[model samples]
Target: MREVDHIEQLVGKLLLLVTPLEDRRLHTDLHNFTHQLSCDRISYSAAALFHIDRSLLTSCIAAIAISIYLVILVEFGLPSLTTSVNNAYGVPNLSEISSYFVCIVMNMYFFVIYLFDIDSTLQGPQKTHTLLSLSLWTGLMVLRLVILAYSSEMVVQEASRTQRLVTKLQMLPVPASSGCQEELLLFEEQLARSPLHYSAAGFFALDLSLLKSFVAAVTTYLVILVQFQIPDTNKE
Candidate 1:
């Protein structure tokens, strides 16, 4: 609860910082004098794909989860973990799929920005710097979450594999294998004692709750795959 409160406080501070940038005419003279550019009606965008604003933060979060979902589908297969859907699934060309999907997703985001006139709200020279700051902060947060998610997943997998290996080792009939079994037991104990985690610049550590959120995101991705009707094929 205290962690949540801390995050809330941080967000409140960021909102306070963004308040000044929201005013399009706030830094007009400064921008013109320093940047030799017009501060009036200046638009903000990222690589010409989508405008930079609060909506961008939401778009980025969605994009990250979608990207993760697509990766899982291509690498781990949908509806099952054992199957690989890369070559045996929809979209004839496996190599170009990612590029094509990225293009489509970007355009979709562009359409959303246009449909809602989000860019019009951010007109001003200072808006660019504001957007950049927000983008940087959001990117860092996303990186932290991704690292924590994957790290936790790896730890879980490793623990399960080690447990299985130890179970198998203990069933061995040969007494010479006793030493190997003991070593496996010790390793398992170590794993149990110190679980894996990820941190952001020594600020905070990711834990089980973050892992749950990551899993939920992955689940949402699966739903997206189903909605898109990801091609499933049999190569054999």
Candidate 2:
């Protein structure tokens, strides 16, 4: 989000720097403005943005670990553990009870990838609250991811908006100096040639569709692990 804000500010500065008409009669300072925008601030911004904390690579690693751990624990661990417990004592199998605990941990994880898995929550009649809580936390994670993507998306939106404004300015029927026209044309070309995007290094674009990809990856791995698990009867 901070990166998005910074890029928008740079683009905004560019737009402001280029949009003014230079009238020699009025003794305007238009000439120096372009140099400041193109040299000092833009160079600094490019240096800062070139390595955005390794961008989404860090995010993908953490998200994959959390998602895979939670799904596998919920789908496989609880049921297997439940059958191992001695239910003859009239105690609720730990399967459902464990899921409740996962729910509790999930709440913490959202505020902090400090999250966890479940088995006790699936612990029979108590499963509802725990299951709902897990779902809610997962939903919150989805929301957080979407917000980040949307924030980055604003850079593109702002760039497009700036381009439109520049084009419209160029089409005006009034007489314009060559410098002003050249500035607009240069900025337009830059915008076209260097479109803004967010991604995991260069693997995939960081958009709403990223959520679907994450889910698909987790599900695929879970299935692969389950398929390769050794059955107790077969082991004998």
Best lDDT among the predictions, by candidate number: 2
Off by over 4 Å in 1: 1-121, 176-236
Q: Using alpha carbons, what is the TM-score of model 1?
A: 0.29
- Write one digit per residue (lDDT tens) for candidate 1, span 1-236: 34544555555555455545675454453333433322233457766657767776786575466456545543344224322222243243222323433443444333333334444445466555555555565455456555644665576577567667756856654233224444445545544544333333333333456546544554565456444432331221
TM-score of every prediction relative to native = 0.29, 0.41
Using TM-score, give the best candidate's number. Answer: 2
- What are the Cα lDDT values of the candidates? 0.47, 0.50
lDDT of 2 by residue, 43-109 (tens): 2323343333555466446545644654554455533443343333113313322343344344433
